[model samples]
Target: MTSQNQTFERLCRTGTSLSVHSTYEIGGEARHLALPHTIEEVSTMLEGATSKGLDPFLFGMGSNTLFPDRPSDDMLFFSLKEHIEFKLLPGRLFVSAGTPMTLLALFGLYTGIPSFDFMFLLPGTLGAGVYMNAKYFSHQISDVLETAYVIDKEHPERGLISVPLSGCEYGYKKSVFMRKPWIVVGADLKLPVDPQLTPEQTDELFAKIKSKNLSTSVLPNYFRHYTNELNAAARAGYELRQELLDVITDRGGKKHFDYPSCGSVFKNNYTIGEPMGKLVDRIGLRGTVRGGAMISDHHGNIIQNRGGATAEDVTDLVKLVQEKVEAEFGFVPEPELVIV
Candidate 1:
């Protein structure tokens, strides 16, 4: 393995700050990381890691993730900042996952394409978008994605291969690549150029939507939600229904607001029970607390990390809610993947 001094030459800490806590900014000490400048370099680094008996965890834009206070020490965190390469072909633009989704939206807006307008405000990476089928403002990344380049997990040296869009098997936020450690080198997106929305018009729409979106999120105590609001709202009555959704939106996107929570501490298990919100509420987990983490008062299914929270705090809170819900209801809310 190369000495630590040598590794510093190829990669460096760019910047670090308090990231907004949400799937967008689930809390942890980032130790802001960067990747080598080229794909071959990245491959070599991966190979080097293999030689050293270490595994690197792939991180893109750090969205849709929660980092425990103590993440795996052996894992070398890398970012795709330099890896993202953008290109324009005829009417379509090709983008890489390291490219911010917002950047893509801005590119489309400036260039007069309306398809990416909804993506303008999403807090995720290009690769993350392809993997998560990122959704917001009424569109999913898959709707605009054309193709992507993925590495062969079995063969690190096999390099990146372009994969067809249909093969991604997008459902909700899950995708084929999401379960695997294969890295995203870049991606191609088919876009339109004619009769495009003016940059000003696109910006106006984006600002309005972003404002509405922020107001709906960034609320105190609310963590990320367990399911989409529309589904829950439909379950509730009409006027009350809108109120339900508005409440969710008012909290920052998901389980990462006003606390150090791994968003949606529990995953919704549709077959085992009724909607998750009602079940947890019945157990009185709504507004319950364990250490610094608390089951949100606004939403029963969420566990908020109040401040100075630890992984143990959140985990214990999750366990308490699960046990309570199971005793009261005939079901257990499965944990969304815990970082630790």
Candidate 2:
């Protein structure tokens, strides 16, 4: 469908649609968008939407999508945010996929490199933290990958495909480019070149790593809904928003975020019995609600859309918080993706 005068010369009707509940602002409208830069213009718009068979829904920095209040037209969204680019070599570095894990955490504190200084408290993108093998305290990013590149649309003119970091089978947010669909376009990683800091000690180690990740400049926390098999309590200070609500109300119950959401809606079933985030906060499903979606009055597995919410009000509030937490703790909980 690339000819509506070539999609009005690459579309953008009044832009602003965003996802993952509109930056936790909450759901809908992305009808048709575009934001490519190269890789032959994203293989000529994915071969002009696979010769009109259309199946293009890529977005590197909507942070982590979820747009669906009523907007699909089948699926056509794009945003590799002008496919960034980076390099370094001799111990590896490459990096692209719209770079910005806070500019690889200030290029790992101006190069003294503490493995991308934990991406200055991650928010998203580095291709959604390597398609979800994302991590922080416990580290992972395949521990400094080593190669990736991708594109593989069954050989779209053999564009890009590197592969390698143990062939990306990483887990928890899995990979192999999220089970093969490819199109990452960068990563090499390795690290270690410091040559002993000094450019005034790498600008005083990137101003003490951006002042220890911006000394909590009053609530900006970023995202990370849990996946901590203990990095000694994220190196002791804990905080990934109170370790995702202390791994979900640590047992009995009690969670309730406010406003902001899209954080967690499912994907915490440590075998269901214990640590399913304290059994879905003892089966209360936290703040619970339906219409303008709720559940987060601070964090019962975060739903929040609050005003004029949609995506069927967060898909009927995740089927009424998984049917009242499977009728009070028998345990069921599911609903990690369904903006439609």
Candidate 3:
């Protein structure tokens, strides 16, 4: 056996529950799973999967993904959530794919940069954010992203390839990464001003942020942890920005973390002159239930795992929404939720 194959085997966990890895807290057992903490480790795992004839399924924190109820035995499920890194560059910030997107807001708070406040309570990791052009109101990752680094899934030995912002073909919840077999490794983000912190201070700040022991995949835990951090910062005399405060109010008002959910389940059909949530509301689909899943009463776009929801339950609701909306509104709303 190749060294990479041996290392991959050593790194993988067998018969693991996928629920713990997802924000929705639903899913059955995965036959094989691995969390790669570095780019090299990711490449090694991919190589190993190829040699073993296993189909590799890659994901981040699984905030936007739904794992199947019965996963294929030959599928290798892996995530990059363990590979968090932050680097302060001369003109920009370098963040690893696995770093939680919400951490960027804390970085902004510590560094006195307001640009990342939109990401304050956003779910998922940086790589997923980049892939979907994750948005909050009018703000998005594409607004701050300068460049992305990726590994071609078909050619892992080619190493990292840099794709400039213009090459990304970013649109409403879309990116070139979605069209290609490219795995996002990291990205260089633009900073409006100098962070004004020494390298040691940056390291210290990041370490402090990461030391909080929060589960990024669990909504309630993730919410409380970051909210407390903001409050702690306020007590330390770091003046809180209104934008940051507004994010808390907006997301909090919507009860985003009150239930286990993958946030918005469908993309807004912009051509319809209204959002998917409002459309679902118009048709009286809000608060609709299917098995253990329910359309969030607070927000029509969300499908929550109220308790013990299965992947099929969520997908059933998704299908119901799509069918009802299509019949009433003359179009099928595309799902934003990734069903694995």
Candidate 4:
């Protein structure tokens, strides 16, 4: 479908707030919200927004992000999240930007390839993940990424553009896409796919995983999730059993997932000798509460929403932690979350 053919009236909504769209459940209302399901729809909305002198921004699942208390009426937010695509080709995965990481993981697991297990537990949509070079433990999506289909915001007339992995310049939580007006529409993942796994073998692996009684604690709602590698390691007696358990388990394993909060308020200082969370813990910031926001008693890095917590409440606690942590260690930590 062409943008010229689809009417803007059909794709846009008015008086929508960020709290309803985001995972953090924060942000004020934008003047317009457009749920564009096609490339043409996206282009059309962008053109219309610009023509009206409105500032438009792309929004994904809203994970790891923060927005203002009251957005201006000129702001327009575009979402392509509902138009998702995922399919297994002979050797690679063809996934749209809106596809969930959890689905990617399950696809890999079912095919006898378990490398993406780390991603299964991650939050946010594929587009956001790719833009941020989303990392889990030691792995980032860049490690397995091959090519991404991008919409060059500067030149939408070029149509859907395909760029190789090198064009992205992905780093730890940074990418060229973040710098430019590039919007990822789709991506190709180059991960191992097992063709030898018979129906019996597939069933056996599925049964084994199911038998573990995997916690149905709802991953997106949680602050952190377990990696599939840990499960595989445990099953294979990977020799680092105790160490892996220690690394993977925090506050009674899955308890961290029970709380509503953006996980890890601070980004790790690459030059720091230890994790920022450790410094937060050593400074006795754990269990500190402000309004409905509380520094998790289980992990120092987390600021959880006890109940009915607003974005301001979380910001207050974040400031408090920064003040105390900096005073104690003489090191200011960077925020991993995107505070708009």
Each model's TM-score, in the order given?
0.67, 0.33, 0.97, 0.79
TM-score of 4: 0.79
Judged by lDDT against the true structure, how good is candidate 4? 0.69
Sort by lDDT, top down from the best:
3, 4, 2, 1
Instruction: List residue ranges in candidate 3 displaced over 4 A.
Output: none
* lDDT at position 148, candidate 2: 74
Clashing pairs in 4: none
Q: Model 1, which residues run further than 4 Å from truth?
A: 1-9, 12-38, 81-84, 194-279, 325-331, 334-340
Candidate 3 vs candidate 4: the lDDT winner is 3
lDDT of 3 at 313: 94
lDDT of 4 by residue, 149-263 (tens): 8887666677888889998898767888878888888898986754565667645754554343322223343333345544564476543333234434533363556666566
Over the stretch 160-189, how does candidate 3's per-residue lDDT look in tens digits? 999999999999999999999999989999
Question: Could you give candidate 2's per-residue lDDT for residues 32-151 as a string of tens digits?
Answer: 667766666776777766766657777665544557655666566777655666655577777777654655755553444566656543545577677667765567788888887778
lDDT of 2 at 97: 77
lDDT of 2: 0.58
Candidate 4 ranges with C-alpha deviation above 4 Å: 1-6, 194-254
Better of 2 and 4 by lDDT: 4
